[model samples]
Structures are given as C-alpha cells and as structure tokens.
Target: MTNPTALQLIARSNRLGADSRNTNYAGGNTSAKGSETDPVTGEPVELLWVKGSGGDLGTLTESGLAVLRLDRVRALPEVYPGVEREDEMVAAFDYCLHGKGGAAPSIDTAMHALVDAAHVDHLHPDSGIAFATAADGEQLTKDAFGGRVVWVPWRRPGFQLGLDIAAVKRDNPGAIGAILGGHGITAWGDTSEEAEANSLWIIETAAAHLAEHGHPEPFGSVIDGYEALPEDARRAKAAALAPVLRGLASTDHPVVGHFTDSDVVLDFVARAEHPRLAELGTSCPDHFLRTKVKPLVLDLPANASAEDSIARLRELHEAYRADYTAYYERGAAAARARGEEPPAMRGADPAIVLIPGVGMFSYGADKQTARVAGEFYVNAINVMRGAEAVSSYAPIDEAEKFRIEYWALEEAKLQRRPARKPLATRVALVTGAASGIGLATAKRLAAEGACVVIADLDLERAAAAAAEIGSSDVAVGVQANVTDEAAVQAAVDAALLAFGGLDLVVNNAGLSLSKSLLETTVADWDLQHNVMAKGSFLVSKAAAKVMIDQGLGGDIVYISSKNSVFAGPNNIAYSATKADQAHQVRLLAAELGEHGIKVNGINPDGVVRGSGIFAGGWGAKRAAVYGVPEEKLGEYYAQRTLLKREVLPENVANAVFVLCASDLDHTTGLHIPVDAGVAAAFLR
Candidate 1:
C-alpha cells in the first residue's frame, strides 16, 4: 500500500473539519504520532505531533502543530510542579517546534498521549458533540457507533484524563479510540494519515447519521448581542479579578500566574458577564473532579475596589465549598450503601481561574484541559438554549444529580433490593400537600420514613395534613405560593437548613379550570398556568438547586392528569397545563439525568375523595351533570376505569411513593397512571 503524502493528510483533516462544521463551532483538533528516535541515544525525540490550540483542522497549517515526546509528556505529571514546567515544555520542543512559543497545546493531548498508537486524532464534530451533549449521550453513542468504540464518561483532560484513556485502552485491547461523551471523539491509527482519515470517517458517519434523523442545528450562537466593555471598565475588571483569584487560590494547591498582571486578560474579564464568566468551567462530569463544576462570579458594586471584589469572591468560594460539602455528605450516604469508599478530600479546589476581561478563568489542571472543560460548558449552554427553543429547559432536580454523582452505585443497589420503607430518613417537600393526591402522598412518604415538608397555599390545611401523618419524619407545615419564586426558594432554603438536604420533591400543587377552548378566558388560562404549570416549574427549580448542591440524586414527581394526553370537553385550561407538566418532566429528566436525577410524572385519572375539588359545590355540580349522587361520585369516577375500580388518593400516593423511593432507578421521563387502567392501551 502506498503511504499518503502531507497534502493527502491535510485534505483528510480538512474534510473532517468540514464534517464538524455542520454541528457548529470550528472543527475539532487532531494529532499524529511522528517519527520516533532511538531511546539509547538519550537525546530529544518526537513521539507525537498534536494540533495546537485555536487552529481549525480544516485550515490548519504545518505551523499549527506541537510535537512532544509522548512518553515524557505522560511522565510530566509525576514530577514536582517546578521541575515539570522547566523540563517538559522545553525538552518537548527540542525535537520539533511546530508552532509559536505562545501557542496553546491541543486540549486533548492527554488523550492522544495515552493512545500510544502511531497516530491519533480528536475532534468535536458538530453532530457528535451535539449528540454527546444530550442527556442520553451514552445511549446515543451506542446507537451510532454500536459496540465497537470505547466510550469514556466526560472527564477533564489532564493527567487523570490520560489515566482514564490508558485504562480504556488497557481494558479494550482492540478498541480503535475512545469517545468522550458531552465532549468529542478520539481516533487512532497505525499512521498519521490513517489517524486523520479515521477522524474524518467518524465525523462523516456521525453527520450523515444525524442528518438522516433530522438533527436541528445545535442552537446557533446567542452571544452576539452582548455589548463589548469599555477600556476603563476592562481595567477595573482585571484589577478586581487579580486579588479575587489570588484569594480563592491562595490557600489551595495551585494558584494563578500567567494572566494575573496582564491587561489584555483583565480587559477580557471586564467585558464578560459575571454569570457567564463564572460558568465557563468544563461541562463534562469528570472535569468536576479536576475543576469543581462551577466557578465563583466576582461581582463588585459600582466604584468598588479590588478589595471588595476579593471579598466578594471569597464569600462566593466559601458558599460553593459549603454547598459542595453538603452535597458530598448526601452523596456519601448513597456511596456507603453501594459498598464504595467515600470520596476523600483530594485537595481538589474549585477551578476559579481569573479571566480578567472575559470574566474569570475556568482553571483546570492545565490550559488545554480547561479549554476542553469550557467547551463542554459551552455545549451545555447551547443545549439549554436549543431545548428552550423547543420548550422550557427544565433540568432534573439537584438532589438527583448529587445522588448520581455520589452514589449512583448505591442507587442501583437500592433498586436491586426489594422496596424498603418508602423513604427512609429522606427529607421531602410536597407542594399542594393539603388535599387529594398531595396529602395522601405526603402521608405515604412520611410513613416510609421521610421528613415531609408539607407546603400549600392553605397553611391551616397543610398543618392539619401534617398532623394527620403524625410521623416524627414530618415537619411543621410551610405556607407557600408555589408560583412565587421567592416563596418556593424560601421553602427550599428552610428544608436544606433544617434537614441539611432534600431527597424528593412532589410538585402536586395545581388547580383545574374547566372551560371549552374557545370559551377559555385569558385570565382563567393564566390562573391555571400560574398555579399548575408555573408553580411546578418554580418549586422544582428551587428543590433542584439544593439537590445538585448536595450531590444526591433526588426524585421529582409532577402530578399531571390523564387529560395531558386525552384532552376532554370543557377542560382546556387544565388539559393544556397538564400537557405542559408532562413535557416539563421529560425536559427535567433529560437535563438532570447525568446528575443521577430521575424525573417522572403521575397522571391520575379521576382521583376520588380527599381532593378539595370534590368536597365542595363543584363536586355536587359535577355529580348532577353526570346524573349521579354526590356521595356516589367517587365510585362513579372509579368505575370509569378499565379496572372498574376507583382511583383513591392512596393509589395516587402509592405511585408517587414508587418514584420517590429507590424502586425506579432506570426510570425517568415516564408517566405512571394510577387511574385503574383508564389509559391501558398506551401502557408500555
């Protein structure tokens, strides 16, 4: 077989880059194993030539490469910091200096180093990255690549990243390369041209497959509207970021050095939004182990000094630590149950690099690793935006993520076991807990050993319901208008402060307004939306914040209605909101699944008795309309089901309990019916 020339290799790289562009962003990076020297000589050698940072593969020139002694590069992490810096970068350049001195190395050098193949190439092909960034990235990878490729969970690139890659290669001896979910692809070949060709092939395959499936362009850029900051503003931002970065990292293992005094860096930080800047960390889960998942936003008041910015950053850092500690604890319990050793404090501090004008640095083990992490984050933001375009981007509750992050094995173990007490020692917040399904679910969860927080608009009734449960696991009732963000957030804060964390949230607070589609008034529609749809969204958001911080995968159950699917007469408002509830569950399930959260909805048909709606004039009116005695209404509703049995509040509660407990580990984005088989045909 004829060896490919440089031009051929460049053409293949360009094709891969073109394939990547359809997904958004420039095509990803690529690298190849170059000629190696004799080890006996003890001289400089070139083992790999990896893509340099900020260079698109399609347009890459000979200079857009960085040759490093692969074995030496891998060994650098073991050396002390001082020695590694002086010895590695300079020694690696002795054999070949492909780029300018200041050029950043490709973020995926670690992965390439571990492959140890003759050639390696990695890229964030548009379709692949978009698919990888999805909640079901692993599953999607399986569907696309089948069982041939090695799939690595999202991890920050660096020493650990290399280790993970090595582990994969060791485990899967014949694996061609590894796929990093929520990030991109890694391919290896016997030669540089083969590596480049493999990458192009992978991209072409993914793009073609996704195109056939009608993949939407990953939500296009939304950052164009942000106005650039002024020079004065930029200076102030840099000055402010310097101290904050120092303070946050001063006591930690590594500290910032490169951009601390750079005006260019400061200008970039000042121009960036605080929230956006703080969020620039890696989007992948493994990145968190290297760089704590979130960054601290240092927002100084107008005319505030550097001291103020430092203080603010310190406060935020402390807050992040406190939240992480709490999350670790919650996740620890799950870990213990799974027979896994709890995470030791590895001195892994938050990845809060100072970006100066762009905001702050999203520090990882190194610049390349940080860049990859940032890419993951950017992908997540894009996914959120895209999902928002389709519908609301509701993520799974934080508690669920925490649980997954900490004790996914435990969750699995718990699932394997028979149902234990409904929610042993778990803390739950149940909205609309005063009546109907909410009250019954609260009682059931409390019976199962959960400390239930009953929140309802009716304080008196919520308290009464709490009293009825009478479990030591029950807490004082909290009156809350679920639609009110502050009120819901307060409830979440109280639960976290009081119980130290939360395990479940049942968003059952909702109202039904029956009206024909044409007759539905705007006020009536808004009222139903506010109470049912908006309330669930707000409460879930508040609960998820705590759960994610706690690192415990918590369950969130939205109380949808059968009308979500089978819309009925004079129930336009209720039906629409119910449909929204179902969609909300799916969105949350997708967004929060990686965090180990499982979101599901319950659609109870004709829940009889216990509901306030059935205890008043509305019940009598409904009974008369259906030609049944008011007292017989419950039975009549129950008989409407295929099972010819009434759907009681307890039945709804049981379904809710199943979700809140560990019984449904592999389940999410699902709708369980407690309506006695009314919707039997739709059953999976």
Candidate 2:
C-alpha cells in the first residue's frame, strides 16, 4: 500500500463522507494542498491547491484541483464587492491557469489560501458535524475527547472565517485538528496523511460515541406536525420561509451562486420533506453566521386549502424571524464584547431560503457553513430532549451567556496567556488566615509580591501560616475577630500602618452549620450570619475607607460557597449567609465601582485538605450523622462536579488571585465559581 498524497488524502476523506451516507448534491467540499517552496532558492513561497467549484470530491480528478498564489487569494475579499468579487476571483484563477490546466477554484478557496500551516485539509465529516450540531457542542467535544481537542465556535465564513482559522493556527501551533462550529473540521499536519488520518479518526470516534449514546441520524426521525401538507399550501409555506432563511444567512458569508436566488430557492424548498428539509440545513455554530440558530419548518398538506396553509406559513415565518432577530442581536452583543466584530445586519428582511410544501431552505456561504447552523439546531434539539428528560434542560440564562459572549478579557485569556502581574506594589489583608481559603489567599497574594497581613482569631496559628508563606515579602499575623467591628478596624489599621497602604482585602473568615432549618437554634443562625455575612460587610467597609483615603483604587473579595445558590439540605444558615455575602459583594460593586474599588466573590464547593471548615473531623461526623461512611464523603462531593475532581484550596486560591489582581479590572461584582462546575446543577 502506498502512503496517500495530500490530494489523495483529501479525496479519500471526501469519499468517506459518501460511505457514511452523508452529503447531498454539492453539499460538501474537501481541500488538500501544500505551501510552495522555491525549488532552486529553497525560499518559502505562497502556494495552495484547493478543490474547484462544481465538482464532487468523490469523483474529483487532478484536473478538478485549482492552484493559486496563496497571498493573492487571501487579499481578494477586500478588493471586490460580493458578486463582482466572486467573479473577479474566478477570473484571477483563470489567468493563473493559462499555462497550467486545472479546475476552477473552490468557493472556499480563500479559506485554504489564508491558513498559516503548509499542509491543511478541510472537510465536513458527518460525525464531526453531528458533534458540532449540538447545543452543548463544546461540552460534547470535551466529553468525547476528554479535553484533547481544540474548538472554534461558529462564525460567518469568508475573510472572517479565514482570519479566525489563521488565529487558531497561531494559538495552537501543534494542534492536531480543530472542529469549526456548523462549518466542519480543519485538520493540519506536517504531511497530508497525518491530517487526513486525524480528521477521519476524530469523526469515527465522535460518531461511534454519539451512536453509543443514542444520537441517531438527525433526519430519520419523523416530524410530527408537518408531514401531511397540501400542495398549494406548500408553495405559500415556502415563500414564508425565504426571509427567515435569508436573515440567518446574512450578507457577510461567501456569496456563492446558490445563495443569489434566495426567493426562488425558498419557493423550491417549500415542497420538500419537512424533516429532510430541516436536516439539509447546516448543523453547528460555524453555520450560525450564515444560518441563524434554527431553520423554518413550513408544512403544506396535499389535501389542505392553499389559503389556510399560506396564512399558517406566514405566521410561522414571522415567528421564526422574530426569534432569529433576537438571537442575532444577543449573539452580536456578545461577539462585540468578546472583541469580535458583529456581522452586518443588512435589513429587517432575513436571509431565509424557502422550499415549498416540504419545508424551508437555509443556506450558508457553503455547505460546511450551513452544516454549522444545522449543528446548532441539532444541539438545541438535544438540549430540549435532555430538558424533557430531567423536567427541564435549564442552561445559563441569556444575561450570563451574554456576559461570557462579550467578555473581552475572557476571550483573550482562552489563549492561556499569563495574566499581567499587577500586585507588585499592592498591599493586601486577609482574614481567617490561619488555614483554609484565607491562608491560601494570603500566601497567594504574598507570592504575587504584595505585602500581606494575615489576621485570625488564633494569633499563633495565623503567625504559623504567615511564616510558611515566607519572609521575603512583608507578611505579619494579627489576632482579631472578623465579627467584631473594633477588632476588624484595628487589624485594618495595623495592616495599613505596616504596609504604608492597602489595595486588596479578602474577607475569608466564615463558619458553616449543618442542621435542618427547624432543628437549628436562633443563636446558631445569628453566629453564622454575624461571622460570615456581617463580618464580610464590616471588613469591606473598613477596606473601602482605607482605599478611598489613599486615593488609590482597590479590590475586596468575599469567600462564598456553592450552597449560596443551591441551598444544600440541612445547611440553611450556611447557605443563607453565603447568599447574603454574594448580594453584599454586588451592592459593594455598585457603590464603589465609580471609585475604582472593585468588589467580587469566589464561591467554592467541596474544598478539601488544608481547610478548617472540613478539618474538624467533620466529614466523619457528618458521615456518621448521615449514615454514610466517611470515606465516601469526598467521592460524594467530587462526583457531583462535572470535573469529578477534589476542589483543592489551591484552586480556590487561584480564583481569588484572579479576582483580586488587575486582570479582573472589568470583572467587578462577579461571582466566580471555583467549584469545578458544581453550580451547573442549578444551571441544568
């Protein structure tokens, strides 16, 4: 057997799509080419060979391959208008092929041409597409690969898509492959065989996994509502669908020939099988830029009256457009916040493609692009299904998603760039620092070069913890009760007097009680509330006064817990206090935001080892009290989290550091979870 050449690998992957019973007529394309290297001079030169348009990869020949100077192709989109630009692109290819004969370039030629790697292959593998199609595509991918894959969310394909891929390449210099939402997968390697093998391997792996988990082919299932529509009604339905499809496709994607006749396209779409028609749409986020989150489903029965059907279809279309606009606006705002330019909204008229009687049509710049949209739809369906299974598939609300989508700092950090060292000259005060989150946070601040003052009720224990933190940075231990206003104020004075100024305050002193709401005494509730909730407020107030007096902005972090939101059974006082702490942080943020004093909280769940809360042989006592073995307590909490790992004090420390440091300047009033996804229970 001979090793497959780059083009052969590309062709083989394309054929595999056929074998898997995926792809429709001109539905997906494949590309394989290498960067040009000067033979005589050995200089690296721009070179790319892509599958030309109008040719299926299964039957593609060398003549079907189009060659272009990579540099020139990458620049085409900027110099021409939509249709004129595409025409000029083909013309350029023709001029390049004057001497050497090959097929006209692919519609996605620009994408392949712009990628930074020498050997690149692009395909819309079914399994890969299916995985991308899900609403939890990122989580699904993580579950499938166990944290070994790179993923890029859906974006409109064209210059923007090319740019995104190029950026990913730079970020993951050694990444095996990347799954593009709704669009497909881009696999690269030192050689074509490696790229193709990896792509095929991932697709097969994802498919087998999904099949094992009961995700069948998306189209095989019968759609309940629209299977029996009338013919005249179908045409009206298709017309109604056109705008919704058009709105989703938008104007930013590569404008191919199929996309030009949006109205006629929808007219044809109105007559197809409803399920099959919807399946024809793109399946992932990569397709979102082109196809909105979901496609329109127009049902026209052969026996139904045309007038009634038309009215029904119009109503459906209007509903779809309204939903799509809302989704787009939400997504646009998120994208903008994440530093990504929003897609141009051409008009109120959507980019929908209508299909008669059968369903509606939604198109992307290309097939893979549409597949991305389809993937999102599929994921949405899965989410709906899972929700049904568990009574509801609750996800983070729109506001939270919006925050994540628009968070510029978060997106920047995804590249794992080391955050800026911002506490070089800062001074910090940490309470309850003898052990647990407080001690960990104090040590962390000291490590970051901040002068740290560790305060605790046990002076000796605080001194011991501070000593272990080292002697280089200014670290002192003070004995004080966080709940006592005078004692807390004295500690603050001592810290400021020692360090000359204060910039960060971590109110980490707290107590937890595990008693039923009715079984708990009023004194227990007051004690827990006064220490954890009231104590945090007093410490924050003192810190803010110092910060304001110094004329320098500062940060205050309250240590909260997962119980704050979930309210674990028998933990009423603890849960309520933590919840109050979170609210207090929010109020402080609003009050001090303008003054440059940022306030935030870290909500940790199940933190073990080096934490006093869990150190008093409480796990054993609780286990005995609950009739479970002490050994199982760790497993109990760990299993509840998505990561299924113990929540270490170090993890909480890292989060506290992130919140207090300047890296979180725009992140005030936020509650960061260092709970390994436990709060996701409430989200789900």
lDDT of 2 by residue, 1-684 (tens): 211343564566466445533333343455555445555678765556666765665666666667665556666656645631332454554544322536666446656666665566666555666555455667767777753457878754444566677777778766666777655677666566666566677767766676667523332333334343454444343333332233233333321112222232333333323334343343332232244433555454433454565566557766765775676587787667756665444333233333333333334333333333333343334423322222222233344343333333223323353452456656688989889888878888877767788999999997888788875235878897988998997787666434445678898997766788898899989999999898998999888876775456789998888777885667788889988998998899999988788998888886767778777665665566556677677667788788888887878889988887656678898888887778553422
Assess the local accuracy of residue 484 in candidate 1 as a C-alpha lDDT between 0 and 100. Answer: 90
Clashes of each: 35, 54
What stretches of model 2 exceed 4 Å from their correct place? 1-421, 624-627, 679-684
lDDT of 2: 0.60
Candidate 1 error regions (>4 Å):
1-422, 471-473, 680-684
User: Per-residue lDDT tens digits of candidate 1, residues 243-295?
Assistant: 33533443444322112223333333344233453353334333333345555
For all predictions, the C-alpha RMSD in Å is: 25.6, 26.6
Best by TM-score: 1
Global lDDT scores for all candidate models? 0.61, 0.60
TM-score of 1: 0.41
